[model samples]
Target: MDSNSFFWKIQAGTAATPEAVKTLGGKIVRVDAEQGSVETSFEGKRDFTNPTGAIQGGFLAAMLDDTMGPALAATLNEGEFAPTLNLNVSFHRSAVVGPILGKARIVRRGAEIAFLQGELYQADKLIASAVATAVVRKQAKAT
Candidate 1:
């Protein structure tokens, strides 16, 4: 199915499957969706200067992984899903405490594989970029 249809299906409860949604300490919010990508946001209270204020590198990796998985799923046929095999992220600058948006987009789709690109942004500023490889799984036939 197309991305729009897939999005609608997930939103309408006819399809879309979500893994989890959580609010980590320090204005960090994350959501994992079944159809396409995971997204996380920071409320801007966390800064990088202070010892406890810094946004850890692991957190950044998690955000990218989450976004990449679902992006691959978005391009799948019904009952199909994608799992990440590899991911890489580059941080451009420190993310402020304000609202941050992470979006993942699929760049390549194949029968059993896909490539996805993700970006984390704070308002108009680009904070990070990610690329991932996903393994697409075919849906089992209903008996």
Candidate 2:
């Protein structure tokens, strides 16, 4: 990893992780900045499950968003952030409360927009997948 890369800074603890990421038990596993791809892991707590004893679709969607967002974020400049403009998700199989794996990549990138895709898996079974568009924005300078 390039020492100056944003993801590197995150791994070095020089960046603040979003509360939503922490709440989802998100952990960065691998990054390929040149390829605009990333691998992430998440924990699906029991609280995330629905009455059917499966992790709710909303929680799975959030995991996919977290994964795809970071794939774009990893390639961003220090002052840039990407917020999802739209996310389309497909649920394959029901996920249970446990460890889940995520993989994401940037499909295309423009000066102000990015297209991304990601997948979620549990015990090697695909649980969900998503494609998303995000708008890249510059952070406001702090006074």
Candidate 3:
């Protein structure tokens, strides 16, 4: 479970299993390791819509996290994990069941924590954006 391999799995569309990426229908578009960034797009399944027919904000936030967390996670060495500490998201417009693009970049990272920024685009229009903080640590060992 190294970041580099994770990036490749995503790029190959053979990402691990039925986890968050699978659930979100995230397909990796690009991973720029030198810049600590990753890009993705989601299926925008209509079932994700809210009462007003707009995609739920939580779903959008998940996409943001899915993008940014992986951008940092994929940089981690084997046995290390980056878990979100906080994520602040802002909605710019309603998304109505269409293409969704997610992009994330690591603002800063170190031994303890990472700061990241992410954006969600609906047909090339910004729909939501987020800033996240994650703490890095060794993956918990099995008992």
Quantify all predictions' global Cα lDDT against the true fold.
0.62, 0.91, 0.84
Q: State the weakest 10-residue window (summed lDDT) of model 1.
A: 20-29
Pairs clashing within candidate 1? 10-16, 17-34, 36-70, 37-70, 37-71, 43-97, 44-97, 44-98, 45-97
Ranking by lDDT: 2, 3, 1
Candidate 1 colliding pairs, count: 9
Q: List, residue by residue over 28-121, the lDDT tens digit for candidate 3.
A: 7887877889898897778899889999999999999998987886687766777899999999999988789999999999889999999999
Local error of candidate 1 at residue 122 (angstroms): 0.8
Give the better candidate number (1 or 2) by lDDT.
Answer: 2
* lDDT per residue (tens digit) for residues 10-76 in model 2: 7789977878999999998998978999999999999999999999999999999999988888888
Off by over 4 Å in 3: 1-15
Over 1-143, each residue of candidate 1 has an lDDT whose tens digit, in order, gives 55444433764568634443233222213433344454545444463224656466656666666556555654566666677888888988876555667777677677787888888777678888889888877656679
Give the clash total for candidate 3.
1
Q: After superposition, how far is residue 77 of candidate 1 from its true place, in Å?
A: 2.2
Q: Rank the candidates by TM-score, best first.
A: 2, 3, 1
